[model samples]
Target: MFDELRKALKDWYKVHHRDLPWRHTNHPYAIWLSEIILQQTRVDQGLPYYNRFIERFPSINDLANASEQEVLNLWQGLGYYSRGRNLHATAKCIVDNYQGKFPSTYKELIQLKGIGPYTAAAIASFAYNLPHAVVDGNVYRVLSRYFGIELAINSSEGERLFKTLAQDLLDEAQPALHNQAIMEFGALQCKPVSPNCSLCPVVATCVALREDKIAQLPHKVKKIKTKQRFFVYHLVRNAKNQLAFTKRKPKDIWEGLFEFPLLEFKSEAEQITFLKDKVQVGAAYKHILTHQKITAYFIIDNFPAAADTEVIYLDLADLEYHPIPRLIDKFLNAHRHQIFSVGQ
Candidate 1:
């Protein structure tokens, strides 16, 4: 059954695979970089960033030598800034410990910062053609539906079972192509909602289709609880018409990103109380992260330099050089005309 499935997947992939840049390269650095950027990110969205990184860094040594801010600046608006930081850190680690050589084995790749099991497996198989199977969300969905497994994917038992099944089903002789086939099958054919079951190569043997459980198979045990956060950002302008900005500190969201002076509130009532005396600049902005829902208000303020030494003032024209959170960027883009004056 696994052999037939593998053959069907390979045939389908040969006809249907997208012409992505990553697929054309066997270079471990390129593969590793693409994997990191694509984590929790879609291919279309991550592709440009991949191209940008390659153009900028081009090599592990270049990436390792580049400043953290440079990497973060390029990674701005991608969200999940830690991935950017980790990408930089891991590159340095590989260069420092391995003397700029990309690790070729799964074991070595996994030890690097931010390189988890899935990423390690990907680089190993895709770069070295190692026998390790890549079991990501796509693999989970494909396996669960085809096998009609009802176990929650987030559970330990389900993880082990699916991973084992994927390994057993892998075409070890062509691990790279096999891994790519299964992932692409899940992404394009066996999609989460309204899958193209009609064209699915394995549709004849798909257990979920026969059992009428395509939507329900591949369950997850954990329910994400989104935390609510309220932010009031002060767009403080000094006498020079320069804006005062603060870099978000570490151990928090938007770390290393710049934002207007911020005051966070515990509740909407608290936010309302704080806003009563202050005037707002624009409509409130709502930003959502995987685990946090934020409602932010921006307000205008005129002041000399504040007591906080961390505050850096920059002209509106010069603001383009700084990296900021998406929310802040949205506010600035919307209010750019209103905020800026005629050339002085």
Candidate 2:
């Protein structure tokens, strides 16, 4: 059954796979860049970023020599910024450690920082044609539905099961082609919701389709609990109206990105009374991340700039030059006048 499914998927993929740029080359650097950019991102959304990275850093040496800020500058609008940071770190590691050569096997690739089991398998199989199966969110959905496996996809046991199954079904004679086929099949045909079952190549062997359990087969036991945080950004400006900016500290969201001087409070009512009386207040802004819901308000302080030791002022013209988060960019775009307004 698995053999037939594999053949059907491969044949279907040969004719149906999207003409992605990264698929054109066996270059490991390009493959790694594409995989990293595609993490937590859809193909349509990640395609442009892949092109940008390739255009800017054509090779491992090029990426290794570039500054982190430059890489992040290119990755400005894309969310999950830590991937951009890791991409730079790994490039430098490859240059310094391996003399600009990417690892040829999954075991060696996995040893690199930020390269996990799934990513390592992808690089090895896709780039080097190693006999390793790459199982990610898409694979989890495809396997659970096709095999009628009623296990939580995020669980340790479930992960091991699906990985073993993916490897068993892989055609070792053509590992790269088979890996790409399965991944593309899951992405285009057996999607997470409302998949095109009528056009599915493996529909005859799909258990969930036959059993009418497509929606519930791929169960996830854990539910993410989002934290609600309230932030007060000090929109301070000197007499010259240069906006105050500061780089975020380590071990937090947007770690390396720049932001305004921030004061976190328990609630919206916990505003600083004296500061409120001194400066004009802006409207509250909401920013959402993977597991956080932030309710933020701007403190438009002008007369006296922030007295904080870490605060550094940026000219209103230079605000866009720094690698700030998308939320900050969004605020700046809407409140350009407020940021440029003359302070009394």
What are the models' TM-scores? 0.66, 0.65
Task: Score candidate 2 by TM-score against the native.
Answer: 0.65
lDDT per residue for candidate 2 within 93-120, as digits (tens), equals 9999999999897878998877898889
Q: After superposition, how far is residue 254 of candidate 2 from its true place, in Å?
A: 39
lDDT of each: 0.89, 0.85
lDDT by residue (35-72, candidate 1, tens digit) is 99999999999999999999999999999999999999
Q: How many angstroms is residue 164 displaced in model 2 relative to the true structure, after the best TM-score fit?
A: 1.0
lDDT of 2 at 182: 87
The reply for model 2, stretches above 4 Å from the true place, is 224-344
- In model 1, the Cα lDDT at residue 85 comes to 98
Q: List the residue pairs that clash in candidate 2.
A: none
Off by over 4 Å in 1: 224-344
